[model samples]
Target: MPKALKIAPPDDVLTMLEAGVAGDRVAFDGGSVQLIDAVERGHKVALHAIERNAPVRKFGFPIGRATRSIAAGEHVHVHNLQTALAGQHSYAFDTGANVVTPLPSTATFMGYRRADGRVGTRNEIWVLPTVGCVARTAERIARQAEARVAHLVDGVHAFAHPHGCSQLGHDLDGTRAILASLACHPNAAGAVIVGLGCEENQVAALLERIPQARRGSIRFLVAQASADEMAEGVALVEELARAAMAVRSPAGLDALVLGVKCGGSDGLSGLTANPLVGRMADHVTGAGGSAILTEIPEIFGAEHLLMARAASRATFDAIVTLVNGFKQHFIDHGEPVSENPSPGNIAGGITTLEEKSLGAVQKGGTSAVVDVIDYGVQVRARGLTVLEAPGNDAVSSTALAAAGATVILFTTGRGTPLGFPVPTVKIASNHDLAVRKPGWIDFDAGMVLDAGMDAADAALLQRIIAIASGEETAAERNGEREIAIWKRGVTL
Candidate 1:
């Protein structure tokens, strides 16, 4: 028999757990409903009669309003629902006590201790191009140098991007900031910054942004200045590799920094994968670690939930500015703030931006909002930080890595094979996706539906520790490593 779930007590809709044909009886908590129309799995069915313009509640909040009077057991979707979001609104900081008991720092992982006192999950050599003109050159240097230093470091890779030139003001500054951050990333014990000297982003200017302490292991090369740039790059990497060798030591759980993200989310994402990740976030933060939550536009209708949990009045005010600023960006572009729930999201049974945002924010669990930082800035706070970034998968994931995330917990219901600068643990929201794409999913959060959260949480936490201790994720095995910078300004 098909089954359905009513997520919260105030919810007026039931989400179908399995596909049901017309006239099929589906059971829920209170009563059974005979389907009036054929409904697909993950789709919502009205639990009771709803009048036109009435709020449809899910997750104990209004997802949208009924476009027309909806009969009991009828399908509740885009046809009958409409978003209630409009322009930005004012908000007041709630003075409730938001406290999280810090867990005893018992958990530990084997990691490399950097000279600057930060722990690194990997000790690889990275080649970064300062401009698009030298991207291929950087790649060639990495490929050639990896063979020579394969036994010394974990691996050698290059992150190539195209926005180092023809950008002005903040656009140019953002590009430089991100590059400088990547060069100083703990994962890369040593980095070779390759530059075309004539570009807008000069190697010297970019180097100025990097702290003097981190510059010891970083090498800079100008292709225009050297006759044999590739050979010189390889030699520099070889020297750094020899000097970058460090023994793995036991590091406390407090040393871990996580970037939580979601992509290709389905209806069950909130109930399973996202909430599972939220558990992990709470566990990490409670142990004095840090977790970052980005994708600003996706939080449009659900910002109030986070605002109420702000750690301080200043933190609450920063969140308001972060959210409203993103909304204004949308307005300036002549786009609607509620223009979300991509085609895949609709196919996966998500209805509006509110519904998606509600599910998306679950990755942060119930942690208080500790801080809010701009794009390309590294995380400074030790708890939950809300970052300023858009909702694109690559852009947000890359921003997460640059913000000092040693590992990223990425949840997906529709699956992807993309990885960023760090180890990306892809979690599936349903069992079917995990079984169908084993090569793409590292953990099956769908098991929460059957085995329950306690069993699943322990298993997932074990996997995170193992991955942090040098285990390769599915994305690593497939060689899906890549990075993308947010390009918000004009090309010229």
Candidate 2:
């Protein structure tokens, strides 16, 4: 039997956890009401009669205006509702604030300490290409060198992406930033940078951006400079491998950089996976580590909640710009800003961006917004920071990897089989998804509802430590790794 979940006191709709036939009595705090319609799991049912064109509330806020008069115990979804968001709007700092308690540093995770005082969860050797032209050559070098260097580093893998050449300004800069960030990422004990001569992103300029101490670990090659690029690239990787084979020092939890994200969301996301992950985020940030939250556009309706917890007025202002800028970007592209809660989301009982946003942000837990960063920028602060990115999973996840997230905590309701260059821990929002897709899911956050929250949080924190100590994620085993770069500017 599915019990109806009415999240807030003022909500006029109830999300059914399982289907109920007509006349079934559904109970809430006030009293029990007879069901007048069949409400599927994850779908909503009207708690009270709402007049035509009146607001339909969920998460204790208006999700949309009802298109037709809805009877109490009737289904409420796309057919009877429409979005209410439009254009840019004025925002105040805060009326009510989010609470974040400072947790004592008592927990720790064992990790590898780099020579530059950084920490890495993995010690793989990464091969990065300056342009798409040499992506194949970079991969060839990795494939051939993996066996030769298996006895040295953790593994040798190449990250290949499209669109490196014929790009101007930010487009080209975005490519360089992403590749360079990954090249210097903690997971990479050393890197083999492959460049096709004449590509806009040159080796010397890229090397200049890497940390001064770690620059020595990079091995460079220009495909056009050698007749046998494959052999030359392979030789360079071999040399890089031997250098990376050096022993790594033991490190603690403070060195961990986690990227938190949610995708394919449903009603259960907020109540289950996202909030659970947010608890983990708070744990990591409170323990003196770092956690980054991206998918900027997804934060739309719920921006005010985060703003209330902003560390300073400057950070709040940046959040405003980041939000309004994305709205304007949508306008310039001739797309509606309220175009969200995809078909799948609606089918799964998410009605509006507000509801979605509210649920989405639970992944941040109660952390204060300490910093904001541009796409491709690495995290420096030791708390929660926001990054500029669209809601596209691949692009944002790749950006998270570039931003120095040694491990990515990805929560999903519908679930995705995709993986980034780093270890991606897929957390399922519901037990059914976890049961059905055991191969794809690494954690079952749906259990948060049944098990005690404290026990769940402690278990998840331990799970994260196990992953940090070099346990292989399902994505790594299934070979779903890929990278997506943001292309915002015009191409020449």
Candidate 3:
């Protein structure tokens, strides 16, 4: 039976939420309680009045101190909980070491081992476009390739993105670097670099930049070239797919690059889902495997927590540099970082961006920050590394795979149907969503909150081992391949 039908939330909370502006009454404290002030989405309101200097609570934590006396049941949003006035305190790393014990025996996920010693959870050939102009052609080629060689790999997807041309300096360089990373992604057995002849980003330029070992496995095709003077890129992709499918074999556990991510979060996210994924990351890294945790915007308030676990000053500095860069990027555009938390997050009870970010960073667990790389930079080194990416779910997940993550563990609270071209296992942060979106979500880590549940960390670790060892993720089984790429500038 579907458990979602059974777990009903209090009608009062639901009513209050729907009522938005106009107040609603809820039975509480043996009487009906009335809301004094109505809150707009992405805004805030107080449940009760407080004296001057009193603290404002968000997500059950102190977001900021009241600047002055505030009336009860009044608005306690940006007016009271000031972002600048909020306390930005540091935390001690390894705080959960006492509770989370490492796995006893070494565990492994079945993966595709590459010639250069990288492990991939999915086996596919990505058709890379050197410029955005060729994305449509590349996508067509990928579709044709998948159709022609259905039995070759689990799936094939075109890395269709909005960047790779226009602008100058790091903007252009960033696109190229990211494209290089996608070509070298672990899930891809090989890649076909497609170009439209004349573009800022040329296929030959990429060949010169890519490492010799990576170039060995990649095939390139230009739309301008044809034996009959006709652009038959689809036929080219089919030929490449045949060659890629022929190079298939079992890659071991150590060869995997696990991408860790979370979205649609709530208070329970940090308490359950994030920690569970963290433990799994530790296990994968402990076995000499790689795991990626990105979304730089999401790591805003929690960078210090990660800094403390950094292996060295360089690694820590790298994390800091990325955070500062993102901060500056927003500031330069006159956008506040507080503008980040989505409307869904606000609806789910998250008040401030800091409060939301604190919970979001828990997905990385307690492993030492082994390395910090810029956007699209390949993670050659092992262990836990942070990639520079936006807070957007699909964009970050794509960045993670581009950085060489083989299998991905993505956690969500509000239930997102987002899946990657690679084998992305979606774990719901709460049971309510897990049961509701069974087709989109795989594991329910929400059981951690159930009464009498013993050591959720252990159960979660076991589930990770199972999923890595050939268990199909719900998203994979349902054929969900959601893709989105974050663009730097406005597209007119």
- Compared to the true structure, candidate 1 yields what TM-score? 0.98
- Please provide, for model 1 over 1-492, each residue's C-alpha lDDT reduced to its tens digit, 9 standing for 90 to 100: 346764546888888877888898877776778889888887889888999999999888999999999998899999999899887889998873654554544678888888777888888999999999999999999999999999999989999898799988899999998889989899999999999889999999999989999999899999999999999999999999998877788987788889999999988898889989988888888888899999999998999988988999999999999999999999999999999999998888899999999999989978788999999999999889999889999999999989999999999989999999899999999888999999999999978878889899889988998999899999999988898988988888
- Per-model clash counts, in order, read 0, 0, 7
Tell me each candidate's RMSD, in Å, in order: 1.3, 1.9, 6.1
**Clash count (model 1, backbone only):** 0
Backbone clashes in model 2, listed as residue pairs: none
Number of clashing pairs, model 3?
7
> In candidate 2, residue 51 scores what lDDT?
96
lDDT of 2 by residue, 1-492 (tens): 446753556888887766788888787667656788877777778888999989877767677789999998888887887777788878787632666765845666666788777788888899998888999889989999998889998889998877778888878888888888898898898899999998888888788778787788898889898888888888888898888775555556678888999889887887778888988888888878888998877878778778888888888899889989999999999998888888788777788887788788888878788899998899879888998888889999999999999999999888889988888999998888899998999999877767757777887888888888788888988988899889888866
Looking at model 2, report the run of 10 residues with the lowest lDDT sum. 1-10
Task: Give the Å shift of residue 57 in candidate 2.
Answer: 3.0
Sort all candidates by lDDT, best to worst: 1, 2, 3
lDDT score of residue 118 within candidate 3 = 67
Best candidate, TM-score: 1
Q: Alpha-carbon error at 381 in model 1, in Å? A: 0.9
lDDT of 1 at 133: 94
TM per candidate comes to 0.98, 0.95, 0.80
